[model samples]
Target: MTETEVLAVAGQQAIWACLMVGGPLLGLLLAVGVVVAILQALTQVQEAALAFVPKMVVLGLALMFGGPMAMSVLRTFTEDIFAQMVSVGGLR
Candidate 1:
Protein backbone atom coordinates (compact mmCIF):
# COMPACT_ATOMS: atom_id res chain seq x y z
CA MET A 1 0.00 0.00 0.00
CA THR A 2 0.98 3.63 -0.44
CA GLU A 3 2.26 5.69 2.49
CA THR A 4 -1.01 7.53 2.91
CA GLU A 5 -3.01 4.33 2.84
CA VAL A 6 -0.67 2.71 5.32
CA LEU A 7 -0.84 5.67 7.66
CA ALA A 8 -4.63 5.77 7.44
CA VAL A 9 -4.84 2.11 8.22
CA ALA A 10 -2.51 2.57 11.17
CA GLY A 11 -4.56 5.45 12.49
CA GLN A 12 -7.76 3.49 12.25
CA GLN A 13 -6.14 0.51 13.84
CA ALA A 14 -4.91 2.65 16.73
CA ILE A 15 -8.38 4.02 17.34
CA TRP A 16 -9.93 0.59 17.21
CA ALA A 17 -7.26 -0.67 19.56
CA CYS A 18 -8.02 2.07 22.07
CA LEU A 19 -11.74 1.31 21.89
CA MET A 20 -11.15 -2.37 22.30
CA VAL A 21 -8.89 -1.76 25.27
CA GLY A 22 -10.97 0.88 27.01
CA GLY A 23 -14.59 0.27 25.97
CA PRO A 24 -15.40 -2.52 28.40
CA LEU A 25 -13.88 -0.80 31.41
CA LEU A 26 -15.58 2.47 30.56
CA GLY A 27 -18.89 0.67 30.02
CA LEU A 28 -18.56 -1.04 33.35
CA LEU A 29 -17.83 2.24 35.08
CA LEU A 30 -20.86 3.86 33.44
CA ALA A 31 -23.12 0.98 34.43
CA VAL A 32 -21.93 1.11 38.00
CA GLY A 33 -22.39 4.87 38.19
CA VAL A 34 -25.92 4.66 36.83
CA VAL A 35 -26.90 1.89 39.19
CA VAL A 36 -25.44 3.64 42.16
CA ALA A 37 -27.11 6.89 41.25
CA ILE A 38 -30.50 5.18 40.93
CA LEU A 39 -30.10 3.45 44.26
CA GLN A 40 -29.06 6.67 45.97
CA ALA A 41 -32.01 8.48 44.51
CA LEU A 42 -34.44 5.81 45.61
CA THR A 43 -33.02 5.82 49.10
CA GLN A 44 -32.89 9.62 49.18
CA VAL A 45 -29.30 9.53 50.31
CA GLN A 46 -28.44 12.25 47.79
CA GLU A 47 -24.79 12.21 48.72
CA ALA A 48 -22.94 13.94 45.92
CA ALA A 49 -19.85 11.82 46.40
CA LEU A 50 -21.62 8.54 46.95
CA ALA A 51 -20.88 7.26 43.48
CA PHE A 52 -17.33 8.53 43.39
CA VAL A 53 -15.68 5.95 45.60
CA PRO A 54 -17.35 2.94 44.07
CA LYS A 55 -16.66 4.16 40.56
CA MET A 56 -13.07 4.80 41.46
CA VAL A 57 -12.72 1.34 42.96
CA VAL A 58 -14.34 -0.33 40.00
CA LEU A 59 -12.29 1.65 37.51
CA GLY A 60 -9.12 0.95 39.42
CA LEU A 61 -9.82 -2.75 39.48
CA ALA A 62 -10.67 -2.72 35.83
CA LEU A 63 -7.42 -0.98 35.04
CA MET A 64 -5.46 -3.34 37.21
CA PHE A 65 -6.99 -6.36 35.58
CA GLY A 66 -6.75 -5.01 32.07
CA GLY A 67 -3.44 -3.22 32.30
CA PRO A 68 -1.36 -5.92 30.69
CA MET A 69 -3.68 -6.37 27.75
CA ALA A 70 -3.92 -2.63 27.24
CA MET A 71 -0.15 -2.27 27.34
CA SER A 72 0.24 -5.11 24.87
CA VAL A 73 -2.22 -3.53 22.49
CA LEU A 74 -0.54 -0.16 22.69
CA ARG A 75 2.91 -1.60 22.36
CA THR A 76 1.89 -3.57 19.31
CA PHE A 77 0.47 -0.50 17.70
CA THR A 78 3.61 1.51 18.44
CA GLU A 79 5.78 -1.21 17.03
CA ASP A 80 3.68 -1.48 13.90
CA ILE A 81 3.88 2.24 13.31
CA PHE A 82 7.60 2.25 13.84
CA ALA A 83 8.02 -0.63 11.42
CA GLN A 84 5.99 1.16 8.83
CA MET A 85 8.00 4.32 9.29
CA VAL A 86 11.24 2.41 8.93
CA SER A 87 9.97 0.73 5.80
CA VAL A 88 9.11 4.12 4.32
CA GLY A 89 12.51 5.54 5.30
CA GLY A 90 10.81 8.04 7.53
CA LEU A 91 13.15 6.94 10.29
CA ARG A 92 16.82 6.19 9.84
Candidate 2:
Protein backbone atom coordinates (compact mmCIF):
# COMPACT_ATOMS: atom_id res chain seq x y z
CA MET A 1 0.00 0.00 0.00
CA THR A 2 1.02 3.59 -0.54
CA GLU A 3 2.15 5.75 2.36
CA THR A 4 -1.07 7.71 2.36
CA GLU A 5 -3.11 4.53 2.37
CA VAL A 6 -1.15 3.10 5.29
CA LEU A 7 -1.50 6.28 7.27
CA ALA A 8 -5.22 6.38 6.58
CA VAL A 9 -5.65 2.83 7.79
CA ALA A 10 -3.68 3.58 10.95
CA GLY A 11 -5.73 6.68 11.63
CA GLN A 12 -8.96 4.82 11.14
CA GLN A 13 -7.84 2.07 13.45
CA ALA A 14 -6.83 4.55 16.10
CA ILE A 15 -10.21 6.24 16.02
CA TRP A 16 -12.03 2.96 16.15
CA ALA A 17 -9.93 1.73 18.99
CA CYS A 18 -10.54 4.91 20.94
CA LEU A 19 -14.27 4.65 20.48
CA MET A 20 -14.34 1.01 21.41
CA VAL A 21 -12.27 1.62 24.51
CA GLY A 22 -14.26 4.63 25.65
CA GLY A 23 -17.73 3.67 24.46
CA PRO A 24 -18.70 1.75 27.57
CA LEU A 25 -17.67 4.51 29.95
CA LEU A 26 -19.41 7.12 27.83
CA GLY A 27 -22.59 5.09 27.59
CA LEU A 28 -22.63 4.37 31.29
CA LEU A 29 -22.15 8.01 32.20
CA LEU A 30 -24.87 9.07 29.76
CA ALA A 31 -27.33 6.65 31.25
CA VAL A 32 -26.44 7.73 34.77
CA GLY A 33 -26.86 11.39 33.81
CA VAL A 34 -30.28 10.78 32.37
CA VAL A 35 -31.45 8.90 35.41
CA VAL A 36 -30.03 11.50 37.75
CA ALA A 37 -31.70 14.28 35.82
CA ILE A 38 -35.05 12.61 36.00
CA LEU A 39 -34.72 12.02 39.70
CA GLN A 40 -33.71 15.61 40.29
CA ALA A 41 -36.70 16.82 38.33
CA LEU A 42 -39.05 14.67 40.33
CA THR A 43 -37.56 15.69 43.66
CA GLN A 44 -36.99 19.33 42.73
CA VAL A 45 -33.39 19.05 43.83
CA GLN A 46 -31.46 21.93 42.30
CA GLU A 47 -28.09 21.12 43.76
CA ALA A 48 -25.41 20.93 41.08
CA ALA A 49 -23.46 18.49 43.21
CA LEU A 50 -26.28 16.01 42.83
CA ALA A 51 -25.69 15.92 39.13
CA PHE A 52 -21.93 15.89 39.40
CA VAL A 53 -21.15 13.42 42.16
CA PRO A 54 -22.77 10.39 40.64
CA LYS A 55 -20.90 10.95 37.41
CA MET A 56 -17.63 11.12 39.27
CA VAL A 57 -18.48 7.99 41.20
CA VAL A 58 -19.44 6.15 38.07
CA LEU A 59 -16.36 7.32 36.25
CA GLY A 60 -14.16 6.12 39.08
CA LEU A 61 -15.88 2.78 39.10
CA ALA A 62 -15.65 2.43 35.36
CA LEU A 63 -11.97 3.17 35.32
CA MET A 64 -11.38 0.89 38.25
CA PHE A 65 -13.28 -1.91 36.55
CA GLY A 66 -12.37 -1.26 32.96
CA GLY A 67 -8.84 0.04 33.30
CA PRO A 68 -7.15 -3.23 32.53
CA MET A 69 -9.21 -4.01 29.47
CA ALA A 70 -8.82 -0.53 28.13
CA MET A 71 -5.10 -0.65 28.68
CA SER A 72 -4.84 -3.96 26.87
CA VAL A 73 -6.70 -2.65 23.86
CA LEU A 74 -4.66 0.53 23.73
CA ARG A 75 -1.48 -1.47 24.10
CA THR A 76 -2.49 -3.70 21.22
CA PHE A 77 -3.16 -0.74 18.96
CA THR A 78 0.13 0.91 19.95
CA GLU A 79 2.05 -2.28 19.39
CA ASP A 80 0.46 -2.77 16.00
CA ILE A 81 1.34 0.75 14.95
CA PHE A 82 4.92 0.39 16.09
CA ALA A 83 5.28 -2.99 14.43
CA GLN A 84 3.94 -1.58 11.19
CA MET A 85 6.25 1.40 11.47
CA VAL A 86 9.19 -0.91 11.71
CA SER A 87 7.93 -3.01 8.84
CA VAL A 88 7.61 0.13 6.75
CA GLY A 89 11.34 0.71 7.22
CA GLY A 90 11.37 3.04 10.23
CA LEU A 91 10.19 6.53 9.45
CA ARG A 92 11.88 6.80 6.08
Best by the lDDT measure: 2
* Per-prediction TM-score: 0.90, 0.93
| Tens-digit lDDT track of model 2 for 5-92 | 7799899989989998999999999999999999999999989999999999999999999999999999999998898777676766
Deviation in Å, model 2, residue 72 alpha carbon: 0.6
lDDT of 1 by residue, 1-92 (tens): 78898889888988989898989898999999999989998999988789798999999999998989999988998898888888877654
Task: Please give the clash total of every predicted structure, in order.
Answer: 0, 0
At residue 70, give the lDDT of candidate 2.
Answer: 96
Looking at model 1, residue 81 earns an lDDT score of: 84
| C-alpha lDDT of candidate 1 relative to the true structure | 0.89
Instruction: Give per-model CA RMSD.
Output: 1.4, 1.5
Candidate 1 stretches greater than 4 Å from native: 90-92
